[model samples]
Every structure is written in C-alpha cells, then in structure tokens.
Target chain A: MTAAAADKPKKLVIIDYSGELEKTWATMILASTAGAMEMETTVFVTFWGLQTFVKDKKRITGENWMQKMMSFMQRPGASHRKLSKMNFMGMGPWMMFKLAKKYNVAKPKDLLEMAMAMGVQFLPCQMTMDMFGLKREDLIEGMGEPVGAATALQLMTEADSTLFI
Target chain B: MANLDIKLKVDASGLSCPLPILKATQGIKTVESGELVEVIATDPGSVKDFDAWAKATGNALVEQDSADGKFRFVLRRK
Candidate 1:
C-alpha cells in the first residue's frame, strides 16, 4: 500500500438516533455496504435509536413495573421497530419488509448481522441508557459496550465520511 | 460464457442495490488475492455500483457485460 493511502483512515461513522423502521433499514444497509467497501464503520445508537440494539424479539424482562410497562410499549430490538411514515398503525414496516424480501434484498436484521460479522463497531449510548432506565441486558448481545459523547466526538471529527441518521 | 477462469461466482440476479455489491464482496473474499470473481446480477444499478466499488476497493473490474438481460461483472481481487 502507498504511504499516503495507508496513513489515511477509511472509516465511516454513523450517528443513528432515528427510531423509524425505514430509517433503521437505511442505516443498516449503509453500514453493511460501507463495510463491504472495506471501510471501517461504527454505528452509535442513542435515544429511540437504541431500539436497534434492544433484542425485543426475544423474551424480555424489566427491572420494575414502570420499566416493564415501558418495555411493553417501547420494546428494544430490530424486529419490533416501527416505521416513521405510512405505518398505518404497523402495516408500513411489514409491507416494507415484504417488499425487500420480494426483491431479494437483505432485511434490516440480516444486513445488521452481516455488518456486525464484518467487524463494524456497534455502540450504545450510556447517557441515553441511563435516561431511559435501560440496563445492559436490554440490548442485543455482542455489542461491546456503551460509549459516551467523547468517543462519538473523536470518531465524528476524525472521520471524513460521517452520517447522521 | 467465455472460457475465463473464475475463482468464485456470485449470482445476485433479481436482487436490489447494495445486495449485489454486498454479495460480490463476499464472493471476492473467498478467493485468494489476485484471483478473479464474477458476479451475475439483474439489478440495473449493478453497472455503476460495481465500477465504483472496484475503484474504491482497489480491485480490477476486468470485464462488465450485459447479455440476455443479465449484467455480468468479473473482478480481480487486489
């Protein structure tokens, strides 16, 4: 590799704070695509976006009654994510998934799995977790750890290719 | 089909954008460096996507052709 090319980092950082189904799919698609392109990719999930990391598809437990009720309404995990528009109370996400399947396009969860297997960094937001009363067990397995603002700052500032979605 | 030796072949026909490229990359990695991999895709976007992916990943897009409504791309791993 050329010295200049080797020195330059081909990293893409994504701040995924959107909770909508379409938005989540877009983030996963981009993350997987970038990883395929040989770019080091990181996805920082915060606020509603943390739902992507929440394994709500599996049986979930809450710390307390309020947490349980909240988890019931706002389950964390990719499978139960909702759509931002045309949700029709939930039909939108299902339709989108069906369409993706019809076209042989990978689903959001599959793309996310592929990206994770490819070594894309997946981080939860510590402060946001504290605010939401979510614990580590509420998230998906294999996500290394929760990160703070400073880590996001460094990654965002250092990366020439960064996306806010 | 030409008599070119392909180390790997990925059929991405009927798939959409990003899937084609993603599958192509997966196939590329299975072969040794400098080996060739061919991707068969029906997505119209594969033409430009493969070209750009080749340039970005430092691979060689040795041949790209569309025949019988299928887009074929042969790439050499860098």
Candidate 2:
C-alpha cells in the first residue's frame, strides 16, 4: 500500500439521535453501505434514539402535540432549521416505513439484526439511560456497553467519517 | 412475451422500506447479470424507494406496476 493509503483511517462512526424510523434507516443505510465497501462502522445511539435500542420500546412516539406539530412545521420551510428538513408526517417517515414494508425493507429489529450479522458495533448512550431510568438489562441483546457521549465523540473524531442523524 | 421473458419475484409484502431494499440487495446479489427481480410490495413509498435503490445500486428498473395497494417492481440487475 502507498504511504498515504496506509495513513488513512478505514473506520466510520455515526451518532444517531433522530429517533424516527426513516431517519434511523437512512443512517443505517449510509453506515452499512459504507461498511459494504469495506469500512468499519460504529453506531452510537443517544437520547431519544436510545429508546429504540431498549428491548421493551416498541416505537419512538412524538412527546407532545407541539413536538409533533413542530416536526411537521420544520419540514422544508422552517426558518430555524439547519439540517436536511424531512417530512415525517407527510412523504417522509411514514412513507419510508410503508415502502420499506412493501419492498421488504428490513424491520427495525431486523436492521439491528443485520447490523450484527454484518459486524456493525452497536453502542448505547449512558446519559440517556440515566435520564430515562433504564438499566442495561432493558436493552436488546447484542448491544455493547452503555457509553457517554464524550466517548462516542472521541470515536467519531478518530473515524474517517462521522454523521449525526 | 419475449421482451418480458425474464421474471423474478420478491415478496416484500409485510416488510418495511429499507427491508425491501435490503432484501432486494441480497436478492440481486444472487442474480446473474441482466436477470430481472420482480418485487411485490404494499408500501406506497416503494415507488420512489425502488427508483432510488435502482439508481444507487446500478440496477435497471424495467417496469413498475401498482394496483389494489400493491406495487410490482421489475428490476434488471446490472
């Protein structure tokens, strides 16, 4: 290998906090697609995203009407939005999930399963666990230890690519 | 009949979005070049999702048909 190639990092770290199924799937696709190209991948789920990793959590619900309304309002035309604006209620999240079902998109649980099958590292956020009063046992099987955001950030810093979804 | 001779069917019904793509990805991996994969789905999002998947993965979608809340996708693996 060339000297420059030898110095390059082959790892990717993704910090997923969107909590929406579509966003989560998008993040997974990016990471897994990268991994398919031979990059090592690590996904750190924090805050609301951590709920999806919990064994008993069936779905990530909008906390309130305002949050739900704001989610819809923030799509495309919201003044304060910075990241890619998505329509969760309209053609975004629900649609993505529906198409996924029709096209045999991997189930949320199956995505996790495929991640494991593909050797993707799954890390749960410790602070989120504390905030939610959840224990390690509450998480699905095959998850790594609960880690702090700092540690996750460090991993991201060292990775070739880092994404916050 | 000759033009549509190659037929491949994938039952993505009851599955979710990325799962269909994921399954299609796996299914395509086993198919020879120029073979067609027909995916049956109920999700409305499958329309755009399959289009995007075909674009991203270098697969050619020969046909897409929808009726009665079900979608049929004919993809030619490149």
Candidate 3:
C-alpha cells in the first residue's frame, strides 16, 4: 500500500437517535469494530438517544413479566405493531430494554464503557442537552464536551462512513 | 503442529450480524500480529459477515466451523 494510504485513518460517525434495540446494536458494533481497525470513531447521541448514556438512567433489561409478554407479541415482520407499541405511553424505551436483554445484546451503559475502553469518542449534542435540562455531569463518564450540531455535521462530512440509527 | 496453533477466543454467541464481526475485530486488536482470534457466534448471518469482514479488513480466515446453530471462525490478524 502507498504510504499516504497506509497512514490515512478510517473515520466513522454514528448518529444515535433511537434508544431502541437497533440503535444500540448499531452504535456498539460500529464503535467496537471501527475502534479495532484503529479507526477514529465518534458517536453522537441526540434527543431520545441521550437516555442510553445518561448516568442516572439504568438500561431496562426485559426481565419483567410485562416486557416478556411484549417481546412474545412483537415478532419479525411486525414492524407496524412494534412501532405503534413503541409510541404507547413511553413503552418504547421499556420494550427496547427488554428486547436488548432477551437478545443478549449489551446494555447501552456497557456498550459505552466498551467504547471508552476501545478509545471511541462519545459526544452528546449540546442543544439537546440544554433543551432537556441535562448537565454535563448527568451523562455517563468518559464523554467529551457537548458539541453543536454543526460540529457533528462537520465530522459526518469528513467521515469515511456515517450511519444514523 | 505447534506452528499452526491458534489462540484467543471471543464468545460472540447470541449476537447478530455485524456484532459477531465487530467483536471478532475487537478481539483481534488486542493480540499481536499473526496471532489468531477465534470467534464463536450463534447468528446465522455470521458466516457471510465474517467472510466480508475478513476481506474488508485484510485479515485471513484460517478456519470456520458450524453446528447446532453455532458458528466459529479463526482469523489471523495481518
């Protein structure tokens, strides 16, 4: 390989907006794999995604009876029903936690820790934090300063790959 | 026989596509060059995922085995 090509770093930007099974899995995979490739990775959590990384919030594992029942009902090819239930009185996040546990998917907090251990950069959106009355300390540890959407946009623009989940 | 011995195991069982590959990638990073990382996963998609990942990342797939809904692979880091 050419010297320049060998020296160039792979950049990955993962935008996490959903606090669901899909979003968490996508973020963790990208962070861990890209980090392994010695790539520079940045995970930007915005809006509802912030809950996944908040220190005060524990990832809800679907260990409860109700959650277990919900999982049984939502099968593959049941997207519409799943989406509808997700929007029901904050059932979405609860169900997400249950599914994550049922599937053996790593918890968001664990994923964040793994990302940090792997040297992935984690950023929270400044606007969203302010709107939600969240302080920097409210977030999980190892996170850098809250950045604006413009910064995230710039990072995405410069990335080799970008995913919104 | 000693020369072909591969060490390192990552239990990626119960994980889905991209996760198995992703975990294997991370496990390989913690080892020295030329060392092998064995990934054990239950995802049906892992067979193809590992093939694609090995190609994309310049790693060599030394061995692959599947049985009872479990898939295993040994990857040599380049």
Best-matching candidate per lDDT: 1
Residue-level lDDT of model 3, residues A41-145, one tens digit each, is 998888767656655442221345654453344321102122333557547756876777788766545555667887899898988776655667656678888
The residue ranges of model 3 lying beyond 4 angstroms of the native Cα positions read A1-7, A18-26, A36-38, A57-84, A87-99, B1-3, B17-19
Candidate 1 vs candidate 2, TM-score winner: 1
Most TM-score-accurate candidate: 1
Please state the Cα-based DockQ of model 1 relative to the true two-chain complex: 0.55
Per-residue lDDT tens digits for candidate 1, residues B1-78, read 678899898999998988999888888888999899989999998899988787667778889999899999999888
lDDT of each: 0.84, 0.66, 0.70
TM-score to true structure, per model: 0.92, 0.53, 0.70
| Candidate 3: count of backbone clashes, pairs at least 3 residues apart or interchain | 1
**Cα lDDT for residue A36, candidate 3:** 58
Off by over 4 Å in 1: A1-7, A59-62
**What DockQ was computed for model 2?**
0.15
* Native-to-model Cα distance after best TM-score fit, residue A99 in candidate 1, in Å: 1.5
lDDT of 1 by residue, A104-162 (tens): 87888889888887788889999888876778877887786899989998999988788
Query: Candidate 2's residue-wise lDDT over A80-135, tens digit each?
Result: 11223566345555565567566655645556666665578888888876665556
Between candidates 1 and 2, which one is better according to lDDT? 1
